[model samples]
Structure formats: C-alpha cells, structure tokens
Target: MPGLQTQSIHAGRSIDPSTGAVVPPLHTSTTFERDPDGEFSRRYAYIRAATPNRDSLEACITALEGGDETISFGSGMAASFGVFQALAPKDHVLLHRDVYYGVRELMEGFFAKWGLNHTLVDMRDIDEVRRASRPETKLFWVETPTNPLIEVVDIRAVAEAARAACALLVCENTFATPVLQRPFELGADIVVHSLTKYLGGHSDAMGGSVTLKNKPELVAQIRDFQHTGGAILSPFDCWLILRGVETLVPRVRLHCENARLIAEFLSTHKGVSKVRYPGLVNDPGHAVAKTQMKDFGGMLSFEIRGGRAEAFAFTAALKTIARATSLGGTHSLIEHRASIEGKTTRAPESLLRLSVGLEDANDLIHDLDQALGSII
Candidate 1:
C-alpha cells in the first residue's frame, strides 16, 4: 500500500490517454453516446448515474478511507439522508447526541415524517450504547470528536457494541479526516464524510460520500439510491474536490498544528471558563482520542466566563478570525453554538465553536487575546 501522502496525490489519477494531459479531463456531458448495438460505449451512461469526474473523485476518497467502494452525493446532509432513506420505515437508528445540527434537523423533521425512529445517546459511553440497543436497531451512527464539542468517542468500543447488537456501524469521519483516523480499520462497516469540509479543504466545493468497507449488500442499496435520486455531485465540483484532496495530507497537518497552538492559548486565557479540545491532556475525550486518532483534529470549542452576551461580544471583537458557520477553510471561523442551534441546542449559552484554520499560530493567538480582553 502507498503512504497516505502518496495516495492523496496519485490514487485514482492518470494522464489523459489521447491528450497526454496530466490532469483528468472534466466530463460535463449529461448523457453519453450509444454504440450501433444500442449499448453505451463509455463507462458512463449519464451524469446523474455516473461520470468520469465523479468516478475519479469517488475512487480517490475510497482509497483514502480504506474502503471497498464509495458513493458521492450533492451535500453532506444528502449523503446522510440517503442512508436514512435506505432503511425500512420502522427500522431504528442510534445516533450520537452531539451530531451536526443539520443531522438533528434531518432526523427530527424529515426522517420522523418517514416513520424512522432514532435514539440519541452519548456514543463515547459503550455501556450506554449497549443499553440503548433494540432488536429493531439497524444502524449505529457515530460522529467522533463530535461537532462543536469535539467529544471523541472510542470507535473500536462502539463498533464492538454495534456488532453484538447485529447492527451496521457508520462513522462520520468529517472532523477526523482519513489522515487522522480510519474507522473501517477500527471495525466500522461504513464511513461517511462531508467532503465540503476537510476533503474539499478550500470550502469551494460542496459534496459528501459514503464509503463501504466489505459490505456489499449495503453498498448496492446506497449506490442505487445515489443513482436514482439524482442528487449526485457536479463534475466541476468533483474536479475541485479532487484538486483539494491532492494537498489533503499537508493541509490537515497544518490545521492540526495551528489548532493545537490555539487550544493551548485559549486554555490559559482568563476569559475562557473551559476548553473542549481532545488535544488538551485534561480534556475528557483526550485519552480515547489518543488511542484511536493519529492527530486530535483542527476543530475545538470553549466556554466564555460569562454567558451568551459575552460570547457574542468576544466574536464581534475578533479582527483576524471571521464569524462564520462552516469549517475546514483556510480562514479561521467562530460561531456561537447556542444562537445557531436555538431551542434544541445542547451547547452551553457561553459556548463558542472555533474552526481553527491554516493561519499563523502567533497571529491567531494575538487575535484571540484581543477578543477575550475586550469582553473581559
């Protein structure tokens, strides 16, 4: 097997046979021409069903995740919804309580309307996972280094419980990219990613993927959903994501490095009441994170000494860091979780999630210092 760095650049890549172009050509044609015998000559039949760009992107992501195959979707939420839509009407899904807010909305609104039931549990607690399992539980959904809070769940422990319950285990690997964690190696059956984040790196492309480890049955089902649903990624976006992934290894390394420095700086700041970052030795998730992840990842959150008003003020005072909703971009972003999540928020009123980016460590520290000083 090639090293991750090598695979990131070379996997699923080839020179153009006719043009001798080093980069893969973008295939934007929605439909392909048929042969004289009424059969398609190319590997692709139509854009929605298949395309060179989408195929190349899928192959790269599949290799990165150490999975057998992958299915691409228009957005991360669409990819997640595809899985939920595949389940039987009454099938149960066990999800991490601190998942991305969009997932919460999907389950509570759309999936609920479809008659699928869900149980939200602290996935880091294997005992709680075991206790929550029901005979009808068909899927175990996990999001490690969970959104906003960065709670690192033990993937191996959760996979064990999922196996015992005869359920399919799926790990959302958006935060801890394949560079840091490979859930399939830890015994997960499926790995999901919001390619709009780390894999895209630039936040210029919007995409999602579901990679299957040795499970042919689920793969076929999800593949069918992607094909017939028509929510697949565009060829241009696929090409952009492919470009982003080529530099994934180096970019993620810098993201982790910058985040570690930022986390440490925030921990000692007088205005920060508590910091929730797996990189911090005292963090509740640190021990488990160290065991399963190669790096603690780039996302983290902290609570202000005061409440929502103080958190908002601190964000407003920041000069270098931007106040934004999304993560995994070159620019740093800060968000007030309570305000965004509203009534269903599990985050603290004083909590702010920081998507630490590829910025100078000293500059990031100075910006945070100024922001905190203003609020304090």
Candidate 2:
C-alpha cells in the first residue's frame, strides 16, 4: 500500500454491491431513488450531474494524488476548459510554451479574446518567466517533458514564479502520472490529466480528470461546473479508466525503463540529429528531471537526420511499433509530430515522438534500428 504498485492494486475500486464481483460493475442507471420530500438532488439524478461510477473513479484518483477532490470530464480539453472558465475575466495566465497542441491553440485563438489573457514563455528560463508575469495573472499551466519535445521545466522553480505572481500553478501530470511525480508536494495548486492516454494506458478510453490542492470551494465549483456544464464522462468510460488505474503503477515503471533505453539508443544513432528526453545525462534538464520526477516517463522525441521526408520514411519503416500518436499505451507508438499540430510552432518538423509501451526492449530496439536503416 505504501508503494505505487500496491496502491494501484486497491485504489478507487471494489466489487458490485448487488453481486460479489471483484471488479466494480458498470452502473448505467441514469437516476437513483431519493426521499419523496425533494430534499435531495438524488443519486445519479442526471447523467451530466453525477453517478456512483463517476464518484468511485474520482475517489480513486483523489486517493492516488492525495488531493481533496477530483473531477472527471468527457475529454481532456473539456477539463481544461472548465479550469479556464473558473478563472476570472481579468486573469492573465503564464504558461509553458511547449504545452499540448490543443491547449496551445485554444489559449492563443479563442481564450485570448475571451478576457483570459495568456503569456507563453520558455519556462526553463526563470528570469524570462519572472519577466512575463502580470499582476492579473491567476493560472500558471505547465507540462514537464512536454508533448513530443520532452522538455523538462522545473516545477518547483516555476512554482516559485507562480507564488510570487499570486497565480495558482497547475501541472499536467499525464506523462509522469502521480506515480512518478506528485505535483501537490511540488507546490502545484492543481493537477490535470488526459486519462485517454496514460491513465487509461490502453488508449481505449477518452476521459480527463483534474485534482485540486486542498481547495474545497474550488473543488465544489468544478463539481458544480461538471454537473451543470455537462462534460461528465460516461459511466462506462469512467469504469474503464477505473480498471486502467489498477495497473498504472506497474505499467509506468516499465514505460520509463523502455523510454530511457530508446533515448540512449537514439542519442548514439547517426540517423537521428537530436533526441529529446530528460533521462539522458547530456540533456540540459536532466538534473532537474532527476530531482522532480521519479522516472523520465515513456515519451521521447528525436529529430530525423533530414526533414519531413526522412521522418515519414522512418515512421513508415516501423514493423512492430505502431505509426501513430498518443503516449503511455501498451503498444509502442511513433508519431510524426508536425502532422498533428498543423501550424502550431510547439511541435517541430523532423521530430518523431515515441511512446514506449509494454513491449520488449530488444524488440523495440530492433524495430527502431530497422526503421533508421531504411530511412536513407
């Protein structure tokens, strides 16, 4: 129970009440009975409001993160949008420049004019982050070992930045998971996750969850927003995610090992111009990564020797590894980063991202070796 492996085994799950099943059953009921006085909103009154299945999933996440409250959403973007909506109109936010493409696009495009001002800065530079601060800034969104690039920004350092600016720091712990890194202890006010990826671990479910640090009112507001605004995950998806949680700890450990090996291999490969992973000793953020993260996680990116053509060739040459995006799944995945982000400058061309799954290390090495050999 002390370690992640043990915690994952028993956290946020149980047998059916009606039947003695070990795994929690999917409660598809839209409403639950209440007193006739209308004194209660009733359990599972509305699909959008709340459900036993959703609460069970939230409780598990809450225990795992040591957060007071957690909210589940239909998608990662919906959870993120809810976070923004909870903030004030005059709030200016400082965020990492290399965040997820969808969030970056949303912040720059729609939310910018929606009275929520944002400043995207290279978070590694403490001075730059300090300089970009605005008095009205309220949220500091960050992602370490960021999507595709694997840039490791110092959470504690940025947390200091947020504290000085009077902004609440929120870290996207999807890649590392609570198993690898606890943002709450690192001075983050909130933590976000795309359960569709690592939390689900199979990429079978699309869901998101957010955890608040000791903020009951904030938790209540997000819960209200989830209930009223209606982005709650389906009972089935929540149940699937609940299942994924049972193996998260063990899966993440293996993912980290596989990723580290691949990063080292890619670093020495002549076909790769650059490999971005905090686990590498030569990486600029390696020290900070070691300090903050329990492991460097399963995601790493390498720039192909040539531009888009070489990257495409290399990806197309993969055999066992799937040529696709999304991280922390059981099957290894390779993504041509530029293709998904369109015009966003966050993801670079010639860079290929890898999500090291539960596959054997040697097989993955062979796959990469063959792909690189064929790229020329």
Per-residue alpha-carbon lDDT of candidate 1 for residues 1-376, written as tens digits (9 for 90 to 100): 9999888888888998989999889888999888888888777778888999998899999999999999999999989987888899889999999988889889999999889999999998888999999999999999988998889888999999999999999999999999999999999998999999999999789999999988888888989999988879999999999999999999999999999999999999889999999999999999999999999888999999999899989999999999998899888989998899989989999999999899898999999999899988
- Highest TM-score against the true fold, candidate: 1
Number of backbone-clashing residue pairs for each candidate, in the order shown: 0, 0
**Residue pairs with backbone overlap in model 1:** none
TM-score of candidate 2 on Cα atoms, chains taken together: 0.96
- Position 52, candidate 1: lDDT: 90
Candidate RMSDs in Å, in order, are 0.9, 1.5
Give me the runs in candidate 2 sitting further than 4 Å from their true place.
39-42
Estimated TM-score per prediction? 0.98, 0.96
lDDT values for all models: 0.92, 0.87
